[model samples]
Target: MELLQPGESQATRLHTPKGDVEGVVTCVTPWHFRISVPEDKAALAATWLRDLSDGYVAFDPDPLRRLPGPIVVSDSEAQPVTQATGVPESHLKPYYIGIGSTTDLEPLPAFTWEEREPEQLRRTPLFETHRQMGAKMIPFAGWEMPVWYTSVTEEHLATRQAAGLFDVAHMGVYQAEGPDAGVFLDSVCGNDISALAVGESCYTHFLDPDANVIDDTIVYRRDQDKYLIVVNAANDDKDWAWLNAVRDGKVRIDSQRPWARAFGRRVILRNLRDPKEGPDMRVDIALQGPKSRDILLALGCDAETRKRVLALKRTELCEATIGGFDLVVSRTGYTGEKMAFELFVHPERAVDLWNALLKVGEPMGLKPCGLGARDSLRTEAGLPLYGHELAGPFNLGVGEAGFGSFVKTYKPWFIGREAFLAREKQRQTVVVRFRFTEKGVRMAHLGDPVLDRKGRTIGFVTSCAIDSEGFLTGQAWVDLKYAEEGTPLYIFQGKPQSLGKSPAELKTGDRLLLPTPAVVLSRFPR
Candidate 1:
């Protein structure tokens, strides 16, 4: 008998003692050949092959019909498993047969993730830190990132009840300066930058020529003529490319590569920039929760700074030393709780500052968290993530524009002005919500189907999750027609069983189910 080539299909007819039987010699090895037979004839095939080969052939012997063929089972009863060594395969692993109950089928092309070419994506400075922290890293926005440090539910609860820190250093930071800083921003961003005075910050989105969102970012007005924008990491290059492509006369943009790392201790982003040169910046630390202000007070911040923090207003940048190191204090945070602050610090002093915050805040329920907790907290608070909720340059109409009443009126005209203003007048608006059902509760993820009362799909989900209490929740940007408070909808999770089979579905209330059982507040909405 001839051995089968790696990719070749082969068939064989076996002659047995009891009867003459036909079987496909589907797999071949140096020592033996593997064969497949009809389900009803599986036992007969196994007995015949084993008896004929004696000690020469070896393969999995199961009562079931489907078996991976060409296995060199002579050495042992076990099949020649490629993954026995616990190492991922360097090449495409051979497909093994699985137990089947077949229905109407269609032939299709085959593909694998291993066959795709590598992409040149930038890595964050904190990449190694994430690995050391035991993060379950996954690919996100073209970067390998931690999907969760521990359990998503555990991390989510940690943030809601107390304070959790995140490593968001992967985000993109750009400095826009020159005489045309405002002019350039006006042309590229959707919000008005002309009104961005120094020491002020606002969240805004950039739009493409087609009026789709390019990226949602926070523009920090460092000076009358200088601005800083924090963009999504995956779209950093795209945003730069778009900026360079559309850059008009006089506006200069600088992309901050090798991203500078800073840590937040007491106050974040205080005294973070050089007045004469460098980016006028601050290292931001979010202090959240009812005891957030008390934590600052315990750190020795002045009364004025404490007062500003209490009011959630602009606090005078003051020096409050913690852990024997000083930090520029600014009251800000992402959690919706009463006391939160974004502390600024000198970049060189970031590590010392962060260590200090952890040291002092630990006694008060502050935990050093990774991106996973940060994401869950934000999602629970109904905030939008970059790629999941607002992938720009494509889906701009479904963003925060309709809800940007706070920042829109304050700026000079920015990019997407014409299209946004036009679309905003007649856009479908909806608030995303979490739905837990009696059937299995599945967290809504990106691309999950959003259905209306009649089960007609009207939109798709951007995010979803099962919180600490085991309640499933996710958000979706749907048609305004189905966006009303208390609107009933279903979320479909799995693929349909067949061409005519229905996908998995769950029903949920569209309105805000605040104080819902199993819900926690760990983050302030961005």
Candidate 2:
């Protein structure tokens, strides 16, 4: 091949009793030739070459060149590829590069390099409002936000009893608007994106090629050509990059971290993206509890706004004016509670709206809550949190809300469709909610393992909580062998050293597996 010059194309077929394989030599280097094969056959050629300690190439310039071109049957010890593959000859085929064939088989660029820098923390519109209320502010998802006002227990029970206000402006808000919006969404996203009608929303998973989750997010349909993607705050940058890569170049996307001004009922989003990391105009506040609807109704916004907010169904969105601020309001919440609404507002007016809700909601025992209670409430509802319960296979993070149903199979093409299609046949192991029989408030930590009768590790706890009834509840992913509804399991102090990250993901830690008896609850919580 050293004698061959660059751009001197030659059709070459290798036949060392390895059946017939073909490719076009586009470039010749001193030591090797750059062979371009059909993409489908590319992997085969690469693998075959790696196994060849000795082989000969046959140049076939014949247009009529076909399979079995020069089959020199081998009586030697080393078998041909056909025999090595243990497959029939019918599967082997010849290669043909049409006259003046043009192809691009260049290697992709190397891994990207990024210089690390300390992130500057941010504050919300209600930064002072939280301070005045004596709320404890802490670093959460790169934002200085309240964890609790008085105590997590107080806020948790209040959200259960009456109403509570939560500042959630730090979450990422992104929009993708174009004529091919639905098509772009369906191809790159998991679950049903076009299934949603205008004014409705659905929870979906972003996935990699292996059908592993990138992030679990909510997709809202605002119009026929407009859609809103709400992602976790910490995942804003990564999620944006993933979406852009998979759009198949339909549309260009640029986004930055979202921060806002006013604390309103719903956020009416302006353009949320910028070239640089800057303050975002959209802000969100969650009003939750049994009396949440009543408190929203009592707000001094227009009558139509009140009617619209009241008319929204679960996972529904509508435009409403709270205290005369035009915004989008959605009936959604992480905590499993009735009548909860997340309001998106501008940054400046957030203080006015936050004060108004506290004033009007005083009669309903409404109080401003923080992150501590948010975590507790969501755990009680069996919702998985990032870096805890939810992780897909490869990213080593991102959890599924549940299984199978949310994954759409009808889509002909998607990033992870092939992998998921194959996964459908396998017995699925999903997360389950379990609890200790004894009434106690003590709960398991993130890495605690769940064991079987013989003390073999089956799964580990993802999320845990002790509800008001003293019911210890949590979620975990157990293998099919010990995943029955009435399966007996025990909680150990730490993970088993023998446990490794397998298909079941059973191995989690390196601590002693001492046992505390527990029972497996529903595979999915009711």
Candidate 3:
């Protein structure tokens, strides 16, 4: 038997009472294998199961099927096993599996995760800190991140009632500068960049030629010739590639990307995350809640900076010094809360700044939150998540969003201008707001059918959750004919079934649409 790594191959032979057999590792995840054994050697591989350990066990490839020949039973245990280990395979220490035979339908899956241990995942600067704080780190966008600190419900309420701090360093923060900064941004981004004066930020989208969103981002105008574009972490690479393609095609700038990629002769771009190698070495942090402003105030800013921060309006960014360290602060957030801000600081001082905020804001009931809380908070506010509610290079008519309010047809030119206009004229669908009418109805999920009174599907749920603010809440994209305010609909719930031994045996019943009133879907339902 061979203990094969994912995408790698190996072969080994097993020696037993009857004789010896050869096996090859076929797959790693489900522990698939192909073996060749003489009739006499088959039983020897099956009965060698005394030292059954965790990742080290004997393989019984066909446990449930009638065995080629298996007449060996030990009184110790009768449970069938899947993972095979021991003997001649000991030489392959780090990853070793011995050849074996027998009948077992479902073996415990232990080796799959062994191949993907925690150390194998990418770690952020705060990886150790998160583990110390008891944060349950999970894989997100290729980074090991804390999905929740304590509880999503608790963290959500903390941010709503008091304050919650979030590590947003994983976002893609790019800086574009030089004489053609505004021109480059205006031409590639969907929003009107000329209107973005210094010290201000705006919600915008990077659109493809077809006007569909490459990513929803916040563009901050640092100066007339400089801007900082913050994009979702998951789309960092795609956004970088798209930006280079867009700028290179323009052939007007020649800035460096390693320092910050060059789009033309004067324009240069650099990533904030790579501060050591780039211009900005700032870690992103989000402080949000009803008391968020108070916490920022308590960060020990000077009177002048305090006054400036107090005077700033929403979507505004300003430079300020806190505890003698300079920070870039933005009065914007995703949770739909009034007192929220996104702050950036030097990586060397992130832990200090984080500690300062928690210490200063502890009296105000501030808590360090995780992505789970951030998601729930955003969902409660009826915001659209990239993959779930908004994705692809969408036209004006796509999805359940009408961010066309941010689109500028009056601008000189930009990506997707013509395509967006054409799609706008051919608009055929609309997104709507909805809540379950019947008590005890479960929250809807993506692709769950949305039916009308006659039980015909007119749309499907885009985002749904049994929210803390209210009961079953969700969003759906509907046919223009059925996309009206106060329109009633139903969300189908799929039937349940047991886990299966193989892919073909997995049974899942179709969702049954229940007559529950779900309505109010005009983008912003009100």
Put the candidates in lDDT order, highest first.
Answer: 3, 2, 1
lDDT for 461 in candidate 3 is: 71
Candidate 1, after superposition: displacement of residue 284 in Å?
A: 5.2
Candidate 1 overall Cα lDDT vs. reference? Answer: 0.50
TM-score of 2: 0.68
Measured against the true structure, the TM-scores of the candidates, in listed sequence, are 0.59, 0.68, 0.69
Worst 10 residues of 1 by lDDT: 257-266
lDDT of each: 0.50, 0.63, 0.66
* Tens digits of lDDT, candidate 3, 1-526: 2224445544546554445565433433323333433345445544453332221433433221111122232332222233333424332111113322232222221111011333456666677778899998888876788888888878888999999999887788888887667767876766777777799998888766566667788899887677888888777777876776555543211111111122232457767778454436766889999999999888787789999899879999888887776888899888778789998887777777888898989898999989888887776677777776676223223333656777776553466665666777777776666777755776567767778889787877777765566566777777777766778887675422432245554457634324567776445423
lDDT of 1 by residue, 139-203 (tens): 76666766777676665665667666555545555677654565556556656555555656666
Give the poorly placed runs of model 1, Cα more than 4 Å off.
1-133, 142-144, 178-180, 196-198, 248-288, 296-338, 343-348, 392-394, 398-413, 429-431, 437-440, 467-470, 497-526
Q: Output the TM-score of candidate 1.
A: 0.59
Decide which is better by TM-score, 1 or 3: 3
- Put down candidate 2 lDDT per residue, 123-177, tens digits, no spaces: 8778988898898888877789999889888888889899888988778777766
Error of 1 at 257 (Å): 33
Tell me the number of clashing residue pairs for each predicted model.
30, 15, 22
- Cα shift from native, residue 61, model 1 (Å): 83
**Pairwise lDDT winner, candidates 2 and 3:** 3
